[model samples]
Target: MTEDRPSTVGVLLAGGLARRMGGGDKPMKTIGGRTILERVIAQLAPQCDGLILNANGDPARFAVFGLPVVADTVEGFAGPLAGVLTALDWAAEHRPDVEWVLSAATDCPFLPRDLVERLQRARIAEDAQLAVAASGDQTHPVIGLWNVALRSDLRHALVIEDMRKIDRWTARYKLAKVTWPDKPIDPFFNANTVEDVAKAEQLAALDGA
Candidate 1:
């Protein structure tokens, strides 16, 4: 990071079992002639100092993205919270200067370009320890900002308490809710099914993506 912006890193959370979307990396699916992961990277890369992908299984699967892939230290597809913990640990080790990490879902192709800035601004204004993205009535907990300093506490929660729900853990902190409009297409619309991928394709076309 630089002196102008907050020292922050971006983590693409792709550590999920895509049972509904058949079986495979949902992010690898293409929308508008490009992989969803590519769209996520395109939106997030410029907003942070560095970017990494949090996933399990074979790291080679995401090699084309060329970002560091960090697997959950806590075993068993422990959900997005585990992925967040992995990013926190990775930041602590590789990006010690970065105090915050913005985690976004890989399947969300229309992620806003101002995601990091909005989250950071909300956290600062609310004096929050964490900030999550929201649209209309829905809250996307996986797409949030986490404090690197909470890595130790997060690891203990996952390893000791077996904490899997993101909301459950985030409740312990002063959390901020940063919302974006759900018009035309929700910025946080995630591709969890084949139908969603098609819808994303249409949305991508509309955005000239």
Candidate 2:
């Protein structure tokens, strides 16, 4: 991670049960002739100084990505917040110069290329501790920028504060929102099932929005 841009590291949260996908590494599945994880990496790698994958189980399976892998700091699957915690812990300890992390779901191949820049600018403009992307009327808490300084607070919240909801975590800190237009195809589109994978493939092949 480097402060040269927004001092942000890209964290791809791949830790999921993937019940919708009939129990498989959803990120490893195919989309547009490319693995979902590869597509996301190709899209997000340029926007940040470095990137890491957050997932449990054997890290060897994802070694091809060549980024350090971090698992949940807590015992159980505590959801996106846990992934954020893992990423924060990694950033705080390994990449001290990076103050923020830009997170996106491994399933969201269409994430806007300008995500990091837009969210960083939003956080600064709003004097907020976090910035999340929103589309339609839905708020994407997972797709947000987190302040690495919140690791201690986040850990405490997960263990002591009994906070599990992503909305609850964001509420504790100032939050800024970035909106994505409902274009021909949503930039934040995510694939959660086989059908979704097919749709994502069709969308990926489009020549223009």
Candidate 3:
């Protein structure tokens, strides 16, 4: 962790029902001889003070990773926003000292190493309550830094408002957007399907993973 940045806990969002990839844990798929989850962990572990996983169903499946797996506090699969809320609630309960929760999708194998640092810097510079990453004119709402202070509001949005869209909730506050280059290989590139996995295999070599 950087000395100037607030303490952060990384939350790997794996609670989605991967219906597109034949319905299973997408992060468990292997690429470059390693699971996508493994690659995501390698990229984020050094950038966070601690890490937890937001996943539904049996937590024992991810026991090998040795992370505290938290199910969505919201009953049904409420999308990535639910995962974000889970992280916020978990951080508040287990790591009160942590002020931020960095959430990233587990299927994104090549997340930039500077992810947390850059998001923190941008949020502070803009005096924003949240920060998100962008590449090639596209914003990845799921990959961002969340304020742990907003846990209560997020829970209300999830449980009462029935809010499912991440962007809609983020729009309620000041948000910092950080952009990354897409050339060579987009650092935020994700494998969402079998075809994408094949492409990721090739991109992994370029990423030197």
Q: Which residue pairs clash within candidate 1?
A: none
Q: Write the per-residue lDDT of candidate 3 for residues 1-209, one digit (tens) a residue.
A: 56557789999999988887988999999999999999999999999999999999999999999999999988888899999998998988999989999999998988998999999999999999999999989999999999999999999998999999999999999999999999889989888888888999999887688
Q: Between which residue pairs do clashes occur in model 2?
A: none
lDDT string, candidate 2, 1-209, tens digits: 32224778999999989999999799998876779899889889998889999999999999988988999888788888899999999998999988898888999878888888888888888889889999877788899999998889999999897788998878878899999885787877889999998888888788332
lDDT of 1 by residue, 1-209 (tens): 43334878999999999999998999999998889998899998889899999988999989988999988888888898888888998998998888999998988999998888888888888889999999989999989999999999999999999888999999999999988999878999999999999888888889787
Ranking 1 against 2 by lDDT, winner? 1
Query: How many steric overlaps are in each model, in order?
Result: 0, 0, 0
Task: Please give the lDDT score for candidate 2.
Answer: 0.87
**Lowest lDDT block of 10, candidate 3:** 1-10
Alpha-carbon deviation at 196 in model 2, angstroms: 1.0
Residue 71 lDDT (model 2): 91
User: What are the models' TM-scores?
Assistant: 0.96, 0.94, 0.97
- Each candidate: what lDDT? 0.90, 0.87, 0.93
Give the poorly placed runs of model 2, Cα more than 4 Å off.
Answer: 1-4, 207-209
